[model samples]
Target: MTRNIAMKILLSFLILVAVSACASRQVALVPEDKPFSARKNAEIALLYWIDSLPHVLTTGVDNLIPSPARAAAFQSALEALLRDDPGLAATAAETAGYQVVIFNFGDIRFLALADSRHPGIGPTVIVNPNARRELIAGAPHPVFEEGVDIEAGLFVTRLEARAAIIAGAHACASSVASRCATADNVCPGNGSAPVRVSDAAHNTVLLYQLAHETLAHAWPDSIVFSLRGMMRADNAIVIFSDGSRRHAGVEALPNRLRDGVAATSLSSAGKIVSCQDADDDTLARRSFCGAGNVQGRFLNGSPDACSVDASASSGRFVHLEQGGIVLARLRSAAQLNLSGSAAENLLRGIAAVIPSSEMPMASPDSASGPGQDRR
Candidate 1:
């Protein structure tokens, strides 16, 4: 009996040591010097998944088979939008020939930032205010500045479904633009319109900041538009864009379909809504905020074992929540209810980030091509 008890104690001690050692291991941060050089007229790969079941489900049976037809439709719509854009060469190919890659997975979980040592919610790295100014001066991309807040710690938030899609689209565009800017030594020109606008429902500032970062020149000639979300609701979508400050007695904003969706703006009676004023300090209080703001989460994956695959460093990745725009169409038989008009509008919004002069005019014969298979 004494011998057995001693052996058990020894085994337990060994197990404890092993766990401790594993916990102490740290994952290196992605290199800061990594170049984002996307050539002009470069092919943009659009990768989409039906759901993030692989990340959520444990049992084999729980894994849902994605509908190829749905995936194909989404791909086609996305291709149609980029078909005319001169700045981007859209392709369905995933080969090394492609310069930029955009993944648009439906119902994907945005992982919280993590590492081996601190896996759950990743450690927050505070940036010195002076360093931030220099970083912005050098890069000036949203992915870099979006993550930094007033408190100086990275903030993360869990988003709803549709919001995730919008956020993911914005993220992909920003990444491509950053790469293009780095490669060409000039900001990607916005071809669509001077004033970019979106309804501030469901965190419009996040999207607004993303647009401003990716599309606007250092000194923009036109004002970008962003409005607050619905009354008492925390989420927002781009509902209107006419530069009206008064939220009360405003006419309904037109949706992409020309039909109206019930939406609201920030009340002028209270505080004025501005992206500059809507700093990380204010955002951190929201429940939807992430672990380390946007940049921190982008650099570091989930705070657990499911670290983002840094090895697949082709393009930037973004996780999106399914909100009203996407959720309303969830029950449709098509699986993806995103309309071509809406998709085009969204793409145009992204294109607006690039200057018009930079956007090449496509020939009338420019054919819409199919994108690569879903990964």
Candidate 2:
């Protein structure tokens, strides 16, 4: 009996030693946590802002600014992004109520700022501060940043960020690996104010920031129009399943026929065009579809059907009038490009030019109903 007891004690000792050694290895691999700073917070916020800008802008174009001028416009936008970097950081930090640390990952040349405010929230979880972090973290990579070359720069940045997060993740019990040290009960790092907590958060934030910057550079025209359209429309982008989206109240249409169905509700295709009912049955007669189909009449379901012609330009501007005054004028404007702010302005101008006598405010009943569209 004594021999059995002695053997058991020896086995327990060996197990303890093995566990200790494993923990030591883990701690040795991770970086020591340090103080967080304003720069880091700014970096995190910037990345998030950049990453999310594309979707936001895409959704609100037409009613916002209009079409953008590529050459001169893109440069101006890049400058603006750099200018706003600091403000973004301040906002993110204030929101978290904690300091942050940042690191430039060597591979992608991307930046990762650690938000260590709550070590309990998983180490280094990347954040799109303006949006939900949980959603951002798991989102597809391309959704955030653009022009990520496989060879260098931002690619390296992403790698280093991941490594750092992995290093510091032990701070939270949920992220703490079994191999973590007992002495610390967390990652082997000082929970310094503004210090980056781990890789996950850092990576996610950087991804978002890069995405924003990239989109800003790629689609300046879209940005201006989206904002401008929102201001004019006073409505939000309504998502649809056919991979096509709509920003109503910004663009004028005649009827609501979608996907061969009445535009009385959400649709997958072919609906009637609709608008704020004014007097111009022409503007109220047609609808734009995801497949580039435009059809319908600007009739108020009256015995007298009014035939009208409307045209959609590249930048998503649709011009329609009593006898095509807006469409004819816009079509003749050789300088007008529908893909930029100018196009948005043209759309706005078209809306403004039509005398109230011609345009009609749509009845609330004519509007698309909710959930009429299937994903």
Candidate 3:
């Protein structure tokens, strides 16, 4: 009787294992509709910060309206949340009901979201406290920091990058959907995805995302831009052979050129020498317009800028020794919008201008882009 019972138990165990194997095999073969695990993690990370941030910062411009106005502001945020992800909002409220509260700051220079569990806010405008303060103080948004740890930097960089990539993806998918809907054979699927406004805006956001990731990985603490300095020929300098470039901050450029020049690594090359364009101050800094660095000298450009000077060259492939707004600007602009020859040229220029000290001599592709998987 005991032997018969043992045999029956073994048979049942074998059947259970077979069923489990089949389920595992099926799951592995099927593609997920949504990467739920990844999306959930990202959502959690961002929400933690948003929820922790001073309510006024995220609540927007309705606080002035009496109690009625304040309620309206709260409704707006709730409405946006519901419109974007109704199901998620319901789940969040059911699970963790967070409250809205004001943050008392002696001086509200700027405000941003921070993680409630592992908040990474810096008192300084820039992300890195060690960095010079001006680097982040000058920017419209101070979310980007310099020389931050890969794990922390990747968190913010990814949040921004996703916005850009998703915008582009939505545009592409919607365009295809509209065309397909026109044909009766294949009516467009449900409008699960939203449409994006324009390619330019999407591209701009994407470019910023790439730049943010690149700088975070390349020069976590380097100072790239000055906050208030006027950009003069003296402010910009490049050394291709030694690979180092230094330029002025946002305050230097004319308002029109500020976004174009300050937001890129194109200003490191010597001034444009063409006589006709020289009169145009904008043209003078056009040499670095291409992606790669240029080697030469101007009366104002750096002469022997890479001669073992700690100030001129941070002695690191990317000068991240300092942090603050300089690091923020560098981190932000490192990813500029250029293509084919132009992109290569700009990258080459950056490689040449940044001093090579402790980092390996591998090129950008060989070295791996910033915010890469460390594991």
Assess each prediction's global lDDT (C-alpha) against the native. 0.20, 0.22, 0.23
Give stretches of model 3 more than 4 Å off.
Answer: 1-221, 226-341, 359-375
Name the regions of candidate 1 deviating beyond 4 angstroms. Answer: 1-56, 59-232, 238-276, 279-285, 289-322, 330-333, 340-344, 354-375
Which is better, 2 or 3, measured by lDDT?
3
Q: Candidate 1, residue 239: CA error in Å?
A: 12
Best by TM-score: 1
Ranking by lDDT: 3, 2, 1
> Each model's TM-score, in the order given?
0.22, 0.17, 0.20
Candidate 2, residues 45-158: lDDT per residue as tens digits? Answer: 233322322222122112111123321232232222223342344334334332233222221122233333333222222222121000111111121112111101111122
Please write out the lDDT profile of model 3 over residues 148-245, one tens digit for every residue. Answer: 22212222232121110011111222132221111111112434432121111122122222223333333333323211111233334221111123
TM-score ranking, best first:
1, 3, 2
Q: Model 1 over residues 1-375: C-alpha lDDT tens digits?
A: 133432332222211111121122212223233322221001011111112101111112211111354334223322322332211212221111111122211221111111122111111111111111111111111121121111011110100110111122112222112211111121125432221111111111332223222221221121222211222213332222221111212221211111122211212112222111133224212222222122212222222211221221101111111123322332221232334323224323322332222223112233321111111
Off by over 4 Å in 2: 1-96, 101-107, 112-114, 119-375
Judged by whole-model lDDT over C-alpha atoms, candidate 1 comes out at 0.20
